[model samples]
Target: MEYLLFRLYGPMASWGDPAVGSDRPTALRPSRSALLGLVAAALGIRREEQSLHDKLAASVTFAVKQYSAGVLLRDFHTAQVPSQDKKTIRRTRKDELQTGRLNTVLSIRDYRCEGLWVIAIELTEDAGWDIRQLKEALLKPKFTLYLGRKSCPLAAPLSPKIVTSDCLRSALDTEFEPILKDSDADRVWLPKSDRVTYYWQGRKEATNLTGVSSDKVWDDPVHRQRWQFSSRTEHSASKHREE
Candidate 1:
């Protein structure tokens, strides 16, 4: 088995936190969709091919490292007024665009700073190829990859190899723990668990992967929608290997 590991980092990455309405919520960590999209982009797939309407099968895993913690809140608003062209029964372009310009606002409810960290994305496959070759393929300077959202940027492609569950666990624990002093709050109040792990295995029905689900993926209503893809015969060899 070979896996491609990606290291995601950026000053400000939006992971779409769980929020309501059209207001987008940012993840405190990286996301599967963002990672999958990066892979698709690297493969030179078009936007239409990446749409949820198109099903693509690829497995992914996400490990979140929270070096900093801050509370987030969002708000939304919408209004419909009389159309400028009464006879046409259509709203003007300006009105439509500004209708909800400030529809959402985010504020950090709390503050905790950890500073630096790393999140590993393990993309596994049964392909009979060298992991080093895959890593080399990803290093193409023109290759543009994103984390969960367009705003999130991956730092670099890291070496990928078979990782033991224990090793993964230790890495998460060591880097995520905050050094609390006795003077700190009695409860120490660490950032909401600060560590998350995900594992995705390719499934037949959709282009999306299945396996370990994340609260960020499932609990968020906006992410509840699933993507669909037509399994074309062109990639039959890859498909067969995955199966």
Candidate 2:
């Protein structure tokens, strides 16, 4: 099978989490949701296009190999929320007349500094878009592509290429380097149904990073609506070389 390869590297990135609190968290690697979003943006698919989204998500499967996890950079930010025209404003006394009753909220956002990852996307025969189409769109995206946030832009070109591989493990190892040992390799999350069924393996590693992300991608294939996820298994395996 043919696999599309690309690399995601940036000075800073934020693969967001579903935490509703004073602080926003980020995942170590690119989440499945973000990957889907990247592709959708390339194809210029709006979030409201549920049918289109589901078709794409169901047709493509992805694998990621992280070269560097990067360091965490926490930032403190303050923002002022403007009062709505429909609501009566309570006058808070300030030194300047320009202070028209705004809510100043402080929030902490987490970022990954100097993060790097290699991505491989495989499409089925019934995929929404073919390999060439995907590569073209990515090279010339409909929208500006960012690592995970608008502020965190890409450090380098994606350099998307196509490779022949029997499975995800082979794709990663052939293009990149070897996974010396089990510990040296990161978990490659593969979407699944009842269970993960693939070839050439090792063991799953427990990590704080989770990939059952909240980024909604055509969650329902039938009706084409809502947020849903195909279960994934964090897989590690010995590296292989093509003959």
The lDDT leader among the candidates is 2
> Which tens-of-lDDT digit does each residue in 1-243 have in candidate 1?
223344444334555444454456665444445544554566555665434313322334444444443444333444444334445433465656554432333333211122233444444463333445445545652357754545445443432333334344333333322345677758645443343333322323222323433221432112223432222111000112113
Angstrom error at residue 179, model 1: 21
Best by TM-score: 2
Candidate 2: tens digits of C-alpha lDDT, residues 92-200 = 5442225465777899999988777778888877887889999999999998889878999986788888898765555754453322346744553221122222211
List clash counts for every candidate, in order: 17, 1
Lowest summed-lDDT stretch of 10 residues in model 2?
Answer: 192-201
Q: What is the lDDT of candidate 1?
A: 0.40
Cα miss at 172, model 2 (Å)?
Answer: 1.1
